[model samples]
Target: MPVVDIPGSKSITARALFLAAAADGVTTLRRPLRSDDTEGFAEGLAALGHRVGRTPDAWQVDGCPQGPPAREADVYCRDGATTARFLPTLAAAGHGTYRFDASPQMRRRPMLPLTRALRDLGVDLRHERAEGHHPLTVRAAGVEGGEVVLDAGQSSQYLTALLLLGPLTRKGLRIRVTDLVSVPYVEITIAMMRAFGVEVVRETVLGEDVFAVPPGGYRATSYAVEPDASTASYFFAAAAVTPGGEVTVPGLGEGALQGDLAFVDVLRRMGAEVSVRPDGTTVRGTGSLRGLTVNMRDISDTMPTLAAIAPFASGPVRIEDVANTRVKECDRLDACAENLRRLGADVRTGPDWIEIHPGASAAAGAEIKSYGDHRIVMSFAVAGLRVPGISFDDPGCVRKTFPGFHEAFAAVRAGLPG
Candidate 1:
């Protein structure tokens, strides 16, 4: 068995940074992911005058319950949607003028839902160029939170941004969500809030979901981030595709918090042997892969992982109900289709789904065109395991989440039989 040590969760680290920054005292984060996206989030906090101490093993943050220490700031959010969306909301709780911008790719993503909700909450927000996009400004005088409606159909990060800003307001927040995708991500948010000393009330009234958050701010505590389940999907897929091969990843067992961890169940359904224990999880190849249709709305981040390995299955693989993936780093559905076709696999895409037929020969070497998206690169790398001469146009893009992905993946591949 190849024991792979995956990095910490990007979603968890980002949420922990937000909670720590809004807490009443100092907070320490153990085993946080050090990647481009997370580094940009920490830098955004520093730009707002929060004290963050960094070491190899941990990151300590000096929380500011009264909001950011700075009165004015210009923040660059890089390509991290969490940093771009969450940081401005954090700055809104303080007294100042904060201008936020991002890379061209990040600027093109959806921002209107969160900004509109903030504007409805009485914050003076302006879009520097396009409406509902980045390169915006927030004139902050603190928030007097109350009832507001949000549509998180496009991105759950919009809802998460508002949820993180709840306790920082004077009057708390009562959010009525009209529609939501990725319910598990929101669940992770609520659970982490409780860890930092806040209990969010959830209820359904008149067929709509509502979240009631109290006005008291967070209490700081030492937090340990779990290994990223999404990142672990690649290694698990590797094991599932390689006959007689096995892979184990520690720190993501039955009690793991990330929804992406559920990808193993999808693998198990495809004929791989899976084991989930208290300390870790393992996947072993049984030499047979049976394809079937799967709905991956809540865990859409791993869609590409499944798509990459679909060519090796004995039947057609159909993935459905992941429309939100279109607005991610790239149009993942289309990207997966393009890459799978490039590998000579028969692929088809719909508005929100993909189907891959297993007749095409995927063993031939091909160049994968990575659209500056990390997931695109990582997912296609799995195909390189069986297909010789696989090359990537932009392999370095994995730095957004896992800077050392190639080396780690190479190690796992070297341990497996050819």
Candidate 2:
């Protein structure tokens, strides 16, 4: 058995940063993730004239109660979609102009839905390049925020951006969500907002989901981020793939805020034993991996983890209802099919689902192309635990979320029998 001390949640760290910056006083974030995405967000916040101090243990952010000091600022988001999508709304709360740019991969991701919602809230935004893409400009005099509708099918970050900015609006904020995917992430945003001393009212009105936020903005407080469940999925999948193997991810237990923690239930359904305590959660393989048909819409982040273990299972594995996964760091559905095929698995892919047949044998020293997606790299690494000669083309891409992923993974692999 290996105990993995995984990094903090990237989602929670990002949201906590945004909420802290918008709050009325200083906030301390303990054990926040120190990766490219979160660091990029911290940089963006600093560019807006907010003070961000870093220490070995925590990050102290001086909240901008009234608004950002810079009338105009250039925020570079790198490849972090969370930074690109969420920061624009925070910038809009200030009285100034903000230009946002991202890596080519992130620019290809959808931002039109969120930008459109900002425009509806009376923030002047212009897409400098093609429509719906990044390299956009936001000219802000603060948000009017009456009523707006957004299609959250592309990414839950869109709705989360609006909700984070809701309290700063003049008339408060009322949002109608249509085709909302990743509903659990929205819940995460609301929960974090509540911790920052803001309350978001969520209700269903005539079959549509609506969220209401009053004009009283956030108040700063100290917050601690839990270990990233999405990152923990790799080690958990390793345990499920290796017979009699067990891995414990501490600090992410029954009361964790991340929705991706539900991934353990998926492992449980696949014949793995799961134990949850207040301190941590552990998963052990039953020596028999059972393939299952599951809709991973809410927990789509773990699709690659499940796919990595699917080939080692006793039956066919069918993953469905994750069409939103197509628009992630890459077309993950296609990437999973191609990489699985490269590893000699009989994988079939549709517009939304992937069906992997039972038998999978490694093509001698199979090399997996990560397509610059961190999840793709980590997932395939889990498969390597079972099949020998598994290597990655772009192993460094894990730095986007977990900079020490390979090192941590090596620690887990050290416990595996040769």
**Where is model 1 more than 4 Å wrong at Cα?**
362-364
Indicate the TM-score of model 2.
Answer: 0.99
After best superposition, candidate 1 residue 47: deviation in angstroms? 0.5
The stretch of ten residues in a row with the least summed lDDT in candidate 2 is 63-72
- Over 1-418, each residue of candidate 2 has an lDDT whose tens digit, in order, gives 7999999999999999999999999999999999999999999999999999999889999998556768989999999999999888899999999999999999999888998888878889999998988999988898877999999988899999999998888778999998798888899999999999888999999999999988878899999999999999999988888888999999999888888989999999999999988999999988898989999999999999999889999999999999999999999999999999988899999988999988778766999989999999999999998778889899999999999999999999999655
Clashing pairs in 2: none
- For each of the candidates, the C-alpha root-mean-square deviation to the true structure, in angstroms, is 0.9, 0.8
Question: How high is the CA lDDT of each candidate model?
Answer: 0.94, 0.91
TM-score of 1: 0.99
